[model samples]
Structure formats: C-alpha cells, structure tokens
Target: MAKAYWIATYRSIADPDALAAYAKVSGPAIAAAGGRVLVRGTPAQVYEAGLNERTVVIEFDSVDAARAAHDSEAYQHALSLLGEGAVRDIRIVEGAEG
Candidate 1:
C-alpha cells in the first residue's frame, strides 16, 4: 500500500499559546500512532496564491493509520485544547507509488 500523508496548513493563528499546547499533546499522540513528522514550519518563500503560513506534514504507514491517529482519544484532547485557536486546512492523502 502507498504511504499516507497528513497535511495541515494553518490559514490563521489567533492564539499562539493554545496552538502550542495542542502541539505538545498532539506530537506524542501522533508518534504513538506511528506517524513521522516530515515537515512543520512556515514556508521559506511563497509562490503565486500561496500564503506564508504554518504548514505541517506527517507520514503514516497508510491512510487508515493516519485516520486512526486523527481520531484517537489523545488527539481529540489536543483538539479541545486548540479550540478556535486557529483556522487550518487538513487532509490525508495517499502517496504516489514509484
């Protein structure tokens, strides 16, 4: 099966502290679920129509694993801590095979 990737792009951050709290818990939860964080940061440069915002990418064994990690109890708690802290777009995509 192709590897899966969880991509999150933050459109806006209203509360940095809240987002920080979420990250603390979410990181461990994702690691426990076998996710490897591939990228986490704002873009170094923005192209056309691209916003210079925070983006995160995580690799998982498969799509199912990524979904499970997102729905896990620990992640849910982290989401609660991040309630309305920021606006983000998140997606889980299957990687292309070579």
Candidate 2:
C-alpha cells in the first residue's frame, strides 16, 4: 500500500487562545488516529507562490489510513475545534513507491 501524506497550512488565526485550547484538546487525538505529524512550525522559504503562516505535514501508512484518521471520532472532534481556532487548507497526496 502506498503511503499517504497530508500537507496543510493554517490561516486566519484570529484567536490565539482558541488555537492553544484546540491544540491542547486535539493534539493527542491526532496521535490516536494513527497519524504522525512530520512537520509542524518549520520555516517555509517559498521560492514561488504565496506563503502561509503555519504549516503541518502528517503521514499515514496508506491512503486508507489517512482517510480512516479523518473519519475517526478523535480527528473529527479535533477538526471541530478548527472553526473558531483557525482556518486551514488541507491536501492529501500519495507518496511515491520505493
């Protein structure tokens, strides 16, 4: 099975308290969903296109695993915290096979 990855950028963080609260509540939820956060708060030096403030990358065993994470109750609950916490752009991409 091909590994799956998620690339996301957070925008419109109007409330830092909400972000912190959500992170506190949701951080572990992501781990429970069988996803690994590869990158978080890494500096992005974009050569082209616009840049976003916060970036996150997650990896899963396969596309199915990635979907499972999103569909899981833990991740779903975590997602709920995004409404007032932050706006995000999320994309799922398949990794190249070895």
lDDT of 2 by residue, 27-90 (tens): 6876777789999994557656667568888998888888887778887776676557677788
Model 2, C-alpha of 73: deviation from truth (Å): 1.2
RMSD of 1: 0.6
- The regions of model 2 sitting more than 4 angstroms off are 42-44
TM-score for candidate 1: 0.97
How close is every model to the real structure, measured as TM-score? 0.97, 0.86
Looking at model 1, residue 18 earns an lDDT score of 98
lDDT of 1 by residue, 1-98 (tens): 99999999999999999999999999999999999999999999999999998999999999999999999999999999999999999999999999
Question: What is candidate 1's CA lDDT for residue 5?
Answer: 100
Error of 1 at 12 (Å): 0.6
